[model samples]
Each structure stands twice: as structure tokens, then as C-alpha cells.
Target: MEKADSCRRAAVEAVADVEPPRLYEYIESVLDRASMVPAALTLESAAAMSPEDYVFEDQDGRHCAGESETDRDRTQISEYDSERIVTHAAGVQLIYEGLRLTRSLAHDEPWTVADDDADEGDLAILAADILVARGFYLLARTDAAGKAVRTVQSFGRDQTRRAELEPETASAVGPDGADSAPDSLDANLEHDVLELAVRAGAVAVDETPSPQLLAVATDLADAAGTSFPPVTECLTDLEAKVREQSLEDSTTDRATSATDP
Candidate 1:
């Protein structure tokens, strides 16, 4: 919840100065329903590798590693500048949400002109554009910028491929064929975005993420599947997963150290 709150605040602040108040208003409203987990996941992924302790409290009072009140106040703060990580997390989240909204509009086809003025759908498009642009703005100077761009590019490709799939030909095509199911195609966005979040978070602490970290990240993304789950659902088990990975890393380091001269 702390992570989600931080992400929302950062996201809102990212676009606080946009022109035409209505656009800001629209984006703000959307945030209420948007899953903040993507950004939270980013923070969590980094905190997992951070040398400093991060104590988390919820209804269950599940702490990360510390038991003292002093540690609890840490609230997942990384040794590196957290401002940068928060910004990166917000950027990735905004891009994902913007694309998600755009996809929904495209699928629903709810276009209409409202008495010579842009209607709700038009406003939504504008909002989506603003969201993505702001997201890029936030990430432009960060190391994760390239990954963010590629994620969007991959999304576009997936959507394009989905558009070309014909219902009648879908079954005729093999499981791995061009005419793959729309759900699978749509799910790629979530998977890619989740991966982006993890990479962005991990890089905040370590220069490069280790193989085990990446494998865990991939498993988390796969578990998320096609639909974007609620923040709680996506995050509840994350600490345990990260903790397990961290333990494995420690054990391997110790074994290697013991074998060294």
C-alpha cells in the first residue's frame, strides 16, 4: 500500500502541469481504477536487492526483513536515490496504462462526435497520448529508457498482429502460428510491461540484474497471465518470491567464497 501510494503520487505529479485541465482530470480519474501494482512491483523488485532494509506492513503485518520500529519506518527505501526509481516506476506504469486504455477504446470502437466537439472517446485518446508522453518524459534520462521504448514497440507489434488474426483462421493455424488467439496476443503486453518494471527496479540497485533475478521476474509475469490482476493479488506473494531469490543468492555467494583461496 505504501508503494502504491507513492506510485500514484508520483504519477499524478508527473502530469500535474499538463494543459487543458480536463485532460489532467481524466487521467486522474483513471488512476483510481488503474492497477498501481506495476509501479509497486518496480519498487519491490529493487528493494529486494537493496542493502538497506525495507519493512512492509499491511493487514497481515508482513515485514520484509526487519522486526524493529526503526526498520519499519524505512518503508522500502533503497540505498540509491529513490526519487529516480519512483519516477521510473511511474513512467513504466503510465505507459502501460495508456496503452491499456488505448487498446480498450480500439476494441470497443466507441467513437462519436459530440455536437461538433470531441466526444468522450476523443478526450480519452488525448488523455492516453498525454499519459504515454509524460511517461516517456519521466524515463528519457534514465537507464531504463531503452527498455521502456521497446516495450511500447512490442505492444504495437502485438496489437497489429492481433488485428490481422481472423477468427475462422485462428483455429486452422497451429498453436504457435501467426493466427494465434487474441487473448494470448493481448497478454503479451502485461508480460512485457511486468518485465520492464522488474528491469527498471533492479537496475536502480544493481548495475545489471542477475540471472536468478530475471528468472524470478519472468515467472511473476507469467503468473499474471492475460488479465491485469488487482494490486494486492499481484503483490501479496512478491515479497516471498523476492526473499527466496535473495536467499539463494546469499547461499551461492557463500559457497563461492568458501571455495575461493
Candidate 2:
């Protein structure tokens, strides 16, 4: 549990000042609910776990502004993005979406969306009531509800995989534990989450189905082969890379806007 606490501490440090106190509390609750809380998590954690993860207004603005150009923005990027509403529900949604994406993306169809676009996608507002409110968001309101159902169904088909996935027992292991990698689909918890993280990253960056995205994730899987510390470090690196990329994108957006008029 020392590892979990360290992960939580790092996570807290990541958003202590930026996110509202309630949101931070909510995020903490979600992590605790997951039962396998890692030491530190990046935005990719949200993406990988909760495909329908919600974004705080400030976070979306940072993504839009590419505030990643500075260190301050980099430090504040992973605020409880998944727990937009109910706290622990983010954990449930993460499982649902990861399974959903693993099933959907397995198809040739594309699930790409701008980094911030998923904020309001049909899938964004889950109608789940298991842990939180049921019927909270009926499909009647979502323009993409039809597509969302397909995605959810796809995830449902493979529910067994999650059931088969073993929990990571060893604490703070790094990513080089190839020998320890379970023969199962995820190899273990970190692998499973990383797979979802990459998939989410692909969709968020509009790079789904791209080999490079998968490659990066695979590389991460190997590096963080099987533990929390490595996972934490991997998340930190991914966050910085994403931030830098966001900064560049923001700069380009500005340049294009200057030229377009």
C-alpha cells in the first residue's frame, strides 16, 4: 500500500491547487474505488480508463490554449478528468469505456476525435446507474446515441476479458517485468490500462489505428513492464509529451488564425 499512497500523493501534487477542492476529493474517491490505485496518473490515465472521461473547464481551456508551453500548465494537466460528476463513478466509466474501445477499435472503423472533442461526444454522457445515477443521461439527448450504443455493445461483448484480467499484486514494479507479464490479454493491470491509455490517446489525437500510437503504447508497456513506479514515470513522460505537443498545436493554431483572415 505504500506504493498506492505514493501514487496518490503524486496524483494529489499534480492537481492540488488547480482543481476545485470538491473535484479533487471526487478524484481521490474514484482512485480509491478502483482498488488498484497506482502511485501517479497522467491525463492518459483518464483517457485509457475512461474513454468517456469528462473534462474540467480549465483543463479543456488548457488543451485549447496549449498552455503546455509552460511548466505550470504541465504540472496541472491531470486533474480528475474522469470524475466530472459522481466521484467513484469515473472508475466504473473507465472500465466501461476501456472495454468499449477495445471492442470497438478492434473494428476497422475510426473513433478519432480532437483532444477536447470527446468532452461532448455522445459517449461522453454515460447513462449508467450502477454506481451513480441511472437514466441520468438518456440517449434521447445525444446526437451520437446510435453510434454510442454500438460502441457500448461492442464493449459488452468482451466483458469476459476484464473478468479474466488479474490484479497486480506486486507494488511499485516498473515496466520491464516481461517475465512477469501474465499470459492474459493485459499481461496485468498496468498493461490493460496502458492499452486503453494508448487507444484513448490515439482517439484524442485523431491518431486511432495509426501504428505509431500503438507503438508508443507498446513501448510504454515494455518500459513500465509491470509495476506502479514505472507506470507513474511512464504517465509523467506521456503527459509532458502531450503537453509539448499541445503547445505546438496551440502555436500552429495561432499562426493559422493569423494567416486565415
The candidate that wins on lDDT is 1
Deviation in angstroms for 237 in model 1? 1.2
- Segments of candidate 2 deviating more than 4 angstroms: 1-30, 33-93, 96-189, 205-209, 230-232, 240-261
Q: Write down the TM-score for model 2.
A: 0.33
Q: Which residue pairs in candidate 1 collide?
A: none
Can you list the residue pairs that collide in candidate 2?
7-39, 48-196, 48-197, 49-94, 173-227, 175-223, 175-224, 175-225, 176-225
Error of 1 at 258 (Å): 2.8
Q: Could you estimate the TM-score for every candidate?
A: 0.82, 0.33
For model 1, the run of ten residues with the poorest summed lDDT: 56-65
Candidate 1's error at 243, in angstroms?
1.8
What tens digits encode model 2's per-residue C-alpha lDDT throughout 79-167?
44322211222222344323423433332223366644443232322212111221113222322233334434444443445344335
- Alpha-carbon shift of residue 7 in model 2 (angstroms): 14
